[model samples]
Target: MHILLVGAGLSGAVIARKLAEAGHRATVIDGRDHIAGNCHTERDPETGVMVHRYGPHIFHTDDEEVWDYVQGFMRFMPYKNRVKTTSQGAVYSLPVNLHTINQFYGRTMRPDEARAFIEEQADTSIEEPQTFEEQALRFVGPDLYEAFFKGYTEKQWGCSPTELPASILKRLPLRFNYDDNYFSHRFQGMPEHGYTEMVSRILDHPGIEVHLQTWFDPAAAGEYDHVFYSGALDGYFGYALGRLGYRTLDFKRFTYDGDYQGCAVMNYGDRQVPYTRITEHKHFSPWETHEKSTCYEEYSRACTPEDEPFYPIRLVDEKALLADYIARAEETEGVTFVGRLGTYRYLDMDRTIREALDTVAAYLSDTAQGRAPRAFYQPPMG
Candidate 1:
């Protein structure tokens, strides 16, 4: 089998490696001159720091198989992500923990009391909360919502909380305890080398051929027996239905004398500020040291055709558009959509790779008994 993989990100790289190991001729291509798509990392010539070009990509996953599978390419260093926030001319621990709750309200409440007090504080009205604002108010009340969530949500999503769905705030936890480890994932760490090096090693097999700065063509892909596309799902159809909505980021970087915030990430939760967060790239790879540091102020806006899409909006309007695209994709042939952009969902790096590997396994299983490859491998939500 000859496998053609579009997009040299984790999904493309991992799936290509798997296909090649199965004695298939796999060809991988990307628009960028690098291997890892959004997780691209390179050495800063000036500071000698490993820079995460897209943003701070902390490799965190609870899946033991994913953790062990990724370790084959490069050594990983154990790193915990401690995030802070700047709001109301003051700093606070992120994920809205106990200290933040107490300081914000000027009350000394223990873990259990805090949990109980927050329940008391939450609005009892609006039995079924639909919007983000109503959901937050119902969960943690107005003061805490305004101080921590309102500005940040507005800035990050470019919409008032009322317009957004309650499901958006559901994953963002409000903890009673002081544990500030951002993710509850069991395995969290960074590659000893940068992501580019790791991915480069992953795709450096004899049977694999990598083509950089290549554009997609369905006619061109016909040369291969099977196609695995990790590009935009809507893009595969040439946006015949319409462009599914997406949010993209523009990064502004600055080189400072020393450590800037003493933390890797800081979210500027103020609608007054145009950008959402500032990431210190040097801090992401704490295993290495540099006298100077580089940080990126991230600004998010509607994704343009020219820019790389970072996040899918996945609002009602976008979902409607995506439905039409999925139908068009099902009618098409020889291509399977896999990964975050392919499925039109916001996915972490680990999740994307895991899905890609699973997709290949599903395809191979179907082939062993002699069945045609499906247009997609992901199960639709009921």
Candidate 2:
């Protein structure tokens, strides 16, 4: 079957590659001039170093399949992400670990001592924590909450932590040990040459044809046997159910000599700082040493129609709209919505590739049995 894949991101590119390998013709179209959408990387002409055009994407995943799948294209150097956060004129390690606790309060404590101390600090009155602030206070106490999360959370979400869900803070683990490794993943690294080359290698198939700088017309799906849409889900439906909420990023780039931040990602966990985090590109590639480095001070805001959407703000109201759009999509024909934008959720590249692989495998399984392909393929969750 002939497949029309919209967007040249990881999900679409992986699916297209899989489809072409199964002897299906796939025509990939992206509105952008280059491929590797959000993870787009290119060599800086002046500095001769690889630059992540969007923002720093540290590839960290525990899934061995996802890890091995990515490595098939390009080499990845082992890079542990140890993020430092600054707040209230003090710098601390991330994940609210033992070192962070001891340094902030100016007292040394063992693992058991730290655990007991935090438990005592926790607000016992708040039995059922709902908001982010309440949750943080209940777990990490008032002083740490005010310094680390309160202002930073408010800045990132553009709202007080009281209005936000507790689940946001729950995602971040509070460690007992002094393990500064941000992620507890088995495989963690960035591409040796950068993300662009890896993605380009993925699409290097005889049956695959990639058309960049082209807007995909869903109305012209009749021209092809099937469509794999990875654009905005609401946009695909012409916003008949109203636009879904999304938070997009604005990056301010600057070049610096030698190391700027000491680490790849540094979170400014203070309201005084306009942006949430600063990314130093040179730190991402630990294997290659460069004199000059690039940094991006990232600012997040409500996504406009014209802005490049980074994360879906799937609030209560937006989730309802997404439900409606998803229902509409199920009723529609000849299209499969995959990946972050298409599904209207914030997905790391690993999960995106994993899901895309699942979609292609399901389609191929149906073909093997001589059955009709399903309308969509993705694991819907609560």
lDDT scores in order = 0.87, 0.88
Q: Please write out the lDDT profile of model 2 over residues 117-231, one tens digit for every residue.
A: 9999999899999988889999899988988998887778888898888888888999999999999888999899999899999999999999999997778988998888899
| Clashing residue pairs in candidate 1 (N, C-alpha, C atoms within 3 angstroms) | none
lDDT of 1 by residue, 55-171 (tens): 888999988888988998888998999899998888898889998899888899999999999989899896899999999999899888888899988877888999999988988
The C-alpha RMSD of each candidate to the native structure, in angstroms, is 1.2, 1.3
Q: Lowest-lDDT window of 10 residues in candidate 2?
A: 373-382
Write down the TM-score of every candidate: 0.97, 0.97
Which residue pairs collide, candidate 2?
none
Off by over 4 Å in 1: 380-382
Candidate 2 Cα deviation (angstroms), residue 104: 0.3
For each of the candidates, give the backbone clash count: 0, 0
